[model samples]
Target: MAPPELHPAVLQSVALTVRPTSGAPLALQTKVLDLEPQPDGSTTLVVAPPPGLDPREHHFDATLAWTYPLGRMECTVRTRPGRRAYGDVWLVCANAPATRLQERAYFRARLTVPVLLTWTEATEETEETEETEEQPEPVELHGVVVDLSEGGLLATVPSRPPALGTRVEATVRVDGENLTQPATVVRHVAFASGGHGVAVAFAEPRRHGDRLRAVVFAVERRRRSRT
Candidate 1:
């Protein structure tokens, strides 16, 4: 059977793995900014590049994975530097067709709760800071959890979202228990309600993976039972 055609709407978020000529594979979660259709029926994906990686530096063998309605899908493609689209975003052309992958390990459940995010922003080095050796203070932002899963959760904040690949500590209360996990900023999205949504992947998912799975499963069961 021929591979299915992927639509841009369905390709909201994706996990990108890029292998450099010399170095460890860089894995990141990012959102698709735009899609360009080609004459040969292929599509070029404009996406957020991993932090500190210059697309102009080298070519890469990349694997793109995303969750589809039926299941998860992925494809391998060769990527070369394309024109810079906007701030911190670049284009990568997928030169191959996608293949179906196994079903997702965990289903995301809609859950609304309060979340506290803590992260630090880089500051310019100064003479005083160099002498003191003090680190920058961590900034705290409060948001609401829109969905939950074993892998990560989506939350929205009033202010501009943090930069991608930032390490953050997220704390959420579930069932009277406060769960804190170290997570990475994966993607940023805007909502119609005038706030920004940030998607974060748990850096140490195994620490609270079981608890999150249980909560998600319970939510799923309750929703199904009502219908």
Candidate 2:
């Protein structure tokens, strides 16, 4: 079936393994189809996956990049009826600043480290590759977020330490595919072990504020997958 058209604010991208069992075409680049902002700071981005997906695979993952100016803050965005995205983060700063949206989207590409992210779904344990961690890692942290700010996070990572000044990147993984980015670790301290914590940083913060917001959004996503 032909993919339906989306609004202007929505964006889409696709990545498939070469040598796929189904022998479908190689991966193709994705583009944003439509976009629109919500009154409550959430976004309405409509996206569609690539064509010719494997019938058996039944699973496809895509990366979404939403960039709004400084004044226009947004934190949440939903794509369709089946998928609802939460965790709205905004980079709070004065003036929009001179920057390009493409450059800002770069922050979404920092998941090279390979992390093993685990979350609970339907009372059953689910796991996804957060990064490329070769060795087994243990760190089950979960909690509700108090607020979402620009380039910083306030959450409850019971066993996570505040990775202050240590770069914290975002790694989006699904069924084993991974994409990552290098974020400047700004804050990673414990509010109270087994209670709540805070980790604040940016993806490539040296460049400017453009990336600061990216981390904000990425972390918000991490929070959602947990809940």
Candidate 3:
């Protein structure tokens, strides 16, 4: 159902998808029982246990989404044990606008900046007697940074991309200064547009986290000043 201009108080109910901590995906239909907007910018959500659901299994995470006049709003909720009602179900009071993507420990900024990637390849030894692997020369890859966070970055690569679990060193220039760090390829996807999307997580986020956070803050402030 399409609701009017999105607001915390006006949100009555929402479609909820629950994912158990055991990594089992919920395949049943579910909905918020009674959505009550609470004070202090949080909403109280009540959920009833569906068929074959254990009442004691309230410690799980869920994602809820609903459409509004402006657009669709989605948020991740951490379920907790609520009052002993409705067969001892779970309830949550959260801010609807505080989505999972926006609630990161570190802020992220979208950008179209050039990034340099370097990694080494391991070559198998030709001799059957020698079981040791040879270390090949380091190779360089180029990509455009699409999103930047203190912990990781998402880039679009034009050529063959590295496999997941590959570790690489990356460098990005921000505001005339360069930030370099070691990162691992945690995720990768090939788009129909003929480019690959690579997600790299910093091996030591604390190393260059200050610089990354400063850059993000500066970008945010500059944009806010313009608006």
Best by TM-score: 1
TM, every model: 0.55, 0.24, 0.53
For model 1, where is the 10-residue window of minimal lDDT? Answer: 1-10
The better-scoring model by lDDT among 2 and 3 is 3
Q: What TM-score does model 2 achieve against the real structure?
A: 0.24
Residues 8-75, model 2: lDDT tens digits: 22332322223334655354434444344556433344334345533223222222232232112222
Candidate 3 regions with alpha-carbon error over 4 angstroms: 1-100, 126-134, 225-227
Highest lDDT, which number? Answer: 1
Of candidate 3, the 10-residue stretch with the lowest lDDT total is 1-10
Residue 222 alpha-carbon offset, candidate 2, angstroms: 22
Assess the local accuracy of residue 87 in candidate 1 as a C-alpha lDDT between 0 and 100: 62
List model 3 lDDT by residue over 126-227, tens digit each. Answer: 323353654456789898886687888877787876777888998888777778889888766433233567778888889989888888778778868999
Clashing pairs in 3: none
**Steric clash count of candidate 1:** 0
Which residue pairs overlap in candidate 1's backbone? Answer: none
Full ranking by lDDT:
1, 3, 2
Per-residue CA lDDT of model 1 for 1-227, tens digit only, reads: 22125533324878888887778988877777777767876667777666677856544578888764334668876555556636656566665666655465656777788888999886566323775577777899998887677778878788987798989999988988989999999877544334577878888878998998899889979989999
